[model samples]
Every structure is written in structure tokens, then in C-alpha cells.
Target: MKMLVNVILPIEPFNSMVRDGSVGEIIGRVIDDIKPESIYFSEQDGSRGAVMVVEVPDASAIPSIAEPWFLNFEAHCEFRIAMTPDDLKRANLSKLAEKWNGVHA
Candidate 1:
């Protein structure tokens, strides 16, 4: 399955790493390990952040994906399942809606 991994890096260790010029090398190592399908770096909530679309084989793989950031940078990671248009079509949402539309708890 495709997953959106949101990473929020804290300022303390990250700033120190930037000063020592180790940030790039560390980040490169993590990125290489994760091998995301796509990645974007930006600022979020006044903190350094990265958004990555990664292909995860299973739930067990999540820790491997998130632990690197957690251990290396003390970063927060969030994972969300993502689906392509074709995947959405395969869900048959319209049929589900029809079945549930008039029924509510």
C-alpha cells in the first residue's frame, strides 16, 4: 500500500546537526533507507517538516520506516494510507453509499 509519511523535526538537535553539517548526511541515510516514491521538504507549524509518499509492504514495516527519524532526529512521524484514483474506483464507493445512505445509527 501507498502511505503518506509526515515528518516533523524538532529544532534543538536539528539546529545542532545543521551547524555541524551532519544534517544532510543523516537525512540522506534515512532517505536512502526509506526510498520514498516522492518526497517534499517544507516548513510546518514553524518547524522543519518533510512529506513523503512511500510504498509500505505491511503494517509491520511501519516501525522500520518511522524509527530512523525517531532515533536520529527525535522527529515525529505520521503515516496515512493513500490511494490512487484507480484504487478509489475499485472501492465501489457509490454502491457503498447507496447501501448506507438511508440507514444511520
Candidate 2:
């Protein structure tokens, strides 16, 4: 079974994580190494916060798999879920947009 996990974390530090490129590198390494299937992060306008979604095989992996990352930020354990199509669609689009550049060779 597949799941969609969500976590909300503080913004400024998260942005700092982005500025130092640790967010990108860390998240990429986590996903590539652990192979969560899908995970994503987003920041809201006018809010000093961000949220992330991580798809895991089951809830069992949450503690060991997530603890390290959780320690790096102020977080809330938002969800453990089975993703819907709309959820997957939004994640896929947002993730692609983050990695995409308008220019094509």
C-alpha cells in the first residue's frame, strides 16, 4: 500500500534550508536514497511556514525514517495517508515546476 504523509514546518528556517541548498540536497538525497515514491514541500504566501508530503510504504517507517529530518525544523505531525489522484497530481505538478526551467534544448 502507498501513503501520503504531510508535515508542516516553520518558514524562515526552512527558507534558510533552501538558501543553503540543504533543503534541495537533503530532500533529494532522502528521497533518492530511501525511495519514498513521492515527497514534496511548499510554502504559503504571507505565512512563515511550509509543509512537506512524503509517501512511504506504511506508517511503520515514520519514526526512524523521519526523525532526523524532523529534528532540523519546527514541525507538526500532520498526517499519514493514502493519497488521492488530486493529491498526486498536485504533488507531481509542483515538484516538476520546481525542477523545470522554461528553456528547452
Candidate 3:
């Protein structure tokens, strides 16, 4: 599965916690702390806030894992299931749409 969690962390919190940390350190900590099956930090282009990609084996526990950054507005996540092209080609419209959207973005 693939989850695109877009967080607009308050400036103060970002400064205090994650902004200065090395990518490896932060990714490692997030993995160890949240224990998601796989999580990756993505650097946004010309954007104020950061974005993250998390892959978890199960769909549960996402709320708790995402709770910390729900400070400004709400933490927005676009969740999706991953599949090979052949699999995607055979998917229903709703599923294919999500995958297409991810690719285009």
C-alpha cells in the first residue's frame, strides 16, 4: 500500500523536531517510533511544507501514526493500494483513477 501523508506542521514544531534532522535520521526515527511497514520522507519542490510516503502492510494504526502532525488544519493523507501495470490495467475505474492520480502528481 502507498499513503501520501501531507503535513503542514506548525513552524515551531517543525523547527523543534524534524526540520534540522538529517533525512536518514528522521526516516529512521519515524520508522522506529511509528513502526510503519515502510515510510519515506519526500522533499517537496518550491513548497512550504513537507510531504511523506508511507507503506504499511495493514490499513489499521494509521490514525495514531498520523496523530502527531495534525496540528495545522488537519493532516491530509491520500491512501492507495499499489499494483503492477497489468494489475492496474485490470482494476476498476475508481482504483485505476487513484493510481493514475498518484502517477500524475
Candidate 4:
């Protein structure tokens, strides 16, 4: 499955890592291990944040990807299932709609 990983890091250790010049190296190491299909970096809620899309074989793979951020940066992380355009196109939405057409929210 494809999963989206969002990581939000606090300022203290993140800023400290930047000051010490280890930020890039640390983040790079983690990125290399995960080898995500896509990654974007930006600020979130006034904190350093990243969004990564990667292929996950199973739930067990999550710890390997998230542990780096947790142990190194004390980051707040989230994982969610993701779908590509093709995946959406291939979905059986018609059948799903028929199955729930009369269902209440």
C-alpha cells in the first residue's frame, strides 16, 4: 500500500540540530532509508514539517519509517493511506454506491 507520512517537529531539537549543522545529515539519513516516492518540506503550525509518500509493504514497516523522526527529532508523526489517480480510477465506486445508496450517514 501507499502511505502518506506527515511529520511535525518541535523547535528546540530541530533548531538545535540546525545550529549544530546536523539537521541535513540526520534528515538525509532517514530519507535515504525510507526512499519515499515524493517528499515535501514546509512549516506546519509554526513547526518544521514534512510530507512523504512511500510504498509500505505492511503495518510493520511503519515503525522503521517513523522511528527515525521520533528518536532523532522527537517529531509528531501521522500515517494515512494514499491513492494515486490511477488507483482512484480503478476503484469500484459504482458498486460501492450501489451498496450504500440508501444508507444513512
Best by TM-score: 1
Top-lDDT structure, candidate number: 1
Error of 1 at 32 (Å): 0.6
Candidate 1 lDDT trough over 10 residues, lowest sum: 96-105
Tens-place lDDT digits, model 3, residues 6-101: 654333545545555653465355547665544444444433344556666576767656764453224344445556677666768786677787
Error of 3 at 59 (Å): 3.2
* lDDT for each residue of candidate 1 in 1-105, tens digit (9 for 90 to 100): 999999999997999999999999999999999999999999989999999999999999999899999999999999999999999999999999999999969
- Cα lDDT for residue 42, candidate 1: 97
Task: Indicate the worst ten consecutive residues by lDDT in candidate 3.
Answer: 68-77
**Tens digit of lDDT per residue, candidate 2, span 43-88?**
5444443344455555686775566457766555455566688767
Model 2 residue pairs with clashes: none
Q: Is candidate 1 or candidate 2 better by lDDT?
A: 1
TM-score of 1: 0.97
In model 1, the runs with Cα more than 4 Å from the true position are none
TM-score of each: 0.97, 0.51, 0.44, 0.92
Each prediction's total of clashing residue pairs, residues at least 3 apart in sequence or on different chains, is: 0, 0, 0, 0
Q: What RMSD value applies to candidate 1? A: 0.7
Error of 2 at 55 (Å): 6.2
